[model samples]
Target: MKTPFIVLEGLEGAGKSTVLQVITQWLEQRGIDYLTVREPGGTPLAESLRELIKKDWDERVSPEAELLVMYAARVQLVNEVIKPALAQGRWVIGDRHDLSSQAYQGGGRQLSKNMLAQLSDMTLQGFKPDLTLYLDIEPAVGLARASARGALDRIEREALGFFERTRARYQELAAADPSIKTIDAEQTPEQVKAHVLAVLEAQWPS
Candidate 1:
């Protein structure tokens, strides 16, 4: 089998940073050659798009514009960074992936799911993560945690209802996809860590 493309996904403040550390440590101990990359980033063009998307502008940003920019960044990252890394037999770990666009744009922004699917199929050509660990948390709780982390970015500053819709779509999609698994992010840190580790070990044991 090809080297797995593993992705960690969740709303803001779901402890993905902590989980990433755990994953990296585990991979390092096993001497696994791996590359970690975040969506809307991991390359010069993609990182620039990330900055452009995050920076607040004076005028109201349309949902269509946001969605297009996200896809542009994603395509750049996939072509420039992710695919080559995987082809070289390196484990690719993504902080977020295409699923985020489905939830945030299709569900949160109320865009048509068919349009999102068409774009996904066209851009990715059926590429997908081998294993996606989705940290599930209530929007209110997650937003509260995010707010405490300091200033919110352009997307992060959306209304609570937006995140609620996003969370719903995440749950719906995770339930339907066998490769995606949900971890209860409301648990204590230690507990959540244990659950994450357990899932990781189950899917890709040493």
Candidate 2:
């Protein structure tokens, strides 16, 4: 079987972590070697950048700076972790990837998509995940879940409008791209698990 690069994308508290665990178990059962990676924190430098990005800052951070920092962390992780793991013929399951930037920065922050495109081209040269499972959830529900978890991070603390825009862009992108699959996350965990397993079986029915 070919090594696959699979990415899980969604707003916070959209049940991505649960889906990731399920996928990990499936890979173990199939005896396929796999690596699990989280965006902006898979490498040393990238982890530092993740802290910087998520930390609450006393001073205002410009949207451009926020976008660049995310890309910077992404470039580090891609080069140091994801690419190397894939080169070794290992399947990779990513918690998040470039799509998050598109949704969070481009849509939530209202940054220019052209700028995002330019940055993506410059950093990744059109490289993309083989399969993306996007867990779609209402901002209100997702936010309430996130809030219940404790202190929200910088991005998670954004206004409801920010996440609303992010979810809209996620839906828009999923509709436009066949490789990006959308999973309804508002359902019960059992239903969500069934949908995720169905998607995986359909995509990789070995």
Candidate 3:
């Protein structure tokens, strides 16, 4: 089987971790070599940038700065990690990818689409995942799950309104893009895993 880049996208506590484990198990069963990566991470410098973005700062962080830092981390990871792994015939399973930026920075921060487009074009250069699985969950329910994980990060600490907008954008993007598949994440983990496997079999069957 050809190696394809696959990404899992979701708001916080959308059970992406559980779904990811299902995928890993599926891949192992198929004897496929795969690597896992997280956006704003995967590489040393990118991990550092991730910490900067997630950490609480005394001074207000400019939205533009936040946006640029994310792109910076993305570029590093794409060049240093994802590309290399793909080149070696290893499939990549990404925790989050560019869509997070479109939803979070573009929708939540209300950044200009033109600016987002330009930055994305410059950084990604048309690179994209072959398949994207979106775990769609309501903000309220997702937040409740996230809160149980302890203190929220900077982005997670945002008001409910922010996440609402982000979820709206995620749905819009999935609806418009054929490569993105939206899963009903509010379902039980077993049900969600079954849905995920169905999508994988339909889209990337052995």
Candidate 4:
């Protein structure tokens, strides 16, 4: 049987990194062989794309260009890293995935879901994660947490409305998809961690 592909997603400072540590620890305790990778990365070419996409450029980068570049990196990583690992029976834990594009580009950039779906079909075919943990937070709260970490990246510097749109899309999508479990990230870290672990444990018990 194909191994599972699990993904964590959220707005900036929704504490995805902290959630990742929880997952890795859980996997290690169970002696599960797993590989962790971040979107727009996970391969040499993809990593470069990650930098290009995240860095500030003097020229205005079109939404179409941004979307395409993101897909390119995802394609490379999916083909090279994720697919291979799953084929060999290792669980793949992703920091972000296609859902991110669906929210960020399709929502924040105001691109149509149809357009995003077409791109997803062309690049990813039908492959998708078995489970997704979506940490939901208010944009302002999340952004404040993000900014506290220091310098804001290109996407991080977007106006508040952009993230508001993004968060709305995320909630809409999560509500429609049963495979996605939403955690209230505005709560204390312990509460958020408990919610995440509860979902994970219930989903895949030892």
Which number leads on lDDT?
4
Location of the lowest summed lDDT over 10 successive residues in candidate 4 = 1-10
How accurate locally, in lDDT, is each candidate?
A: 0.92, 0.93, 0.94, 0.95
Worst 10 residues of 3 by lDDT: 1-10
**Compared with the true structure, what per-residue lDDT tens digits does model 4 show for residues 6-97?**
99999999999999999999899999999999998999999999999999999999999999999999999999999999999999999999
Candidate 3 all-Cα RMSD: 0.8
Q: Estimate each model's TM-score.
A: 0.97, 0.98, 0.98, 0.98
lDDT by residue (tens digit), candidate 1, 11-104? 9988888889888888899899999999888899999999999999999889889999999999899988899999999999999999999999
Name model 3 segments beyond 4 Å from true: none
Give the better candidate number (1 or 3) by TM-score.
Answer: 3
For model 3, the local distance difference test gives: 0.94
Ranking of models by lDDT: 4, 3, 2, 1
Score candidate 4 by TM-score against the native.
0.98
RMSD of model 1 against the true structure: 0.9
Residues 1-206 of candidate 3 have per-residue lDDT tens digits of: 65699999999999988999999999999999999999889889999999999999999999999999999999999999999999999999999999999999998999988999999999999999999999999999999999999999999999999999999999999999999999999999889999999999998778
Higher-ranked by TM-score: 1 or 4: 4
Mind sharing the TM-score for model 3?
0.98
- Per-prediction RMSD in angstroms? 0.9, 0.8, 0.8, 0.8
Better of 1 and 2 by lDDT: 2
Per-residue C-alpha lDDT of model 2 across residues 1-206, encoded as one tens digit per residue: 55789999999989889999999998999998999999878999999999999998999999999999999999898888998999999999999999999999999999999999999999998889999999999999999998898999889989999999999999999999999999999999999989988999999997
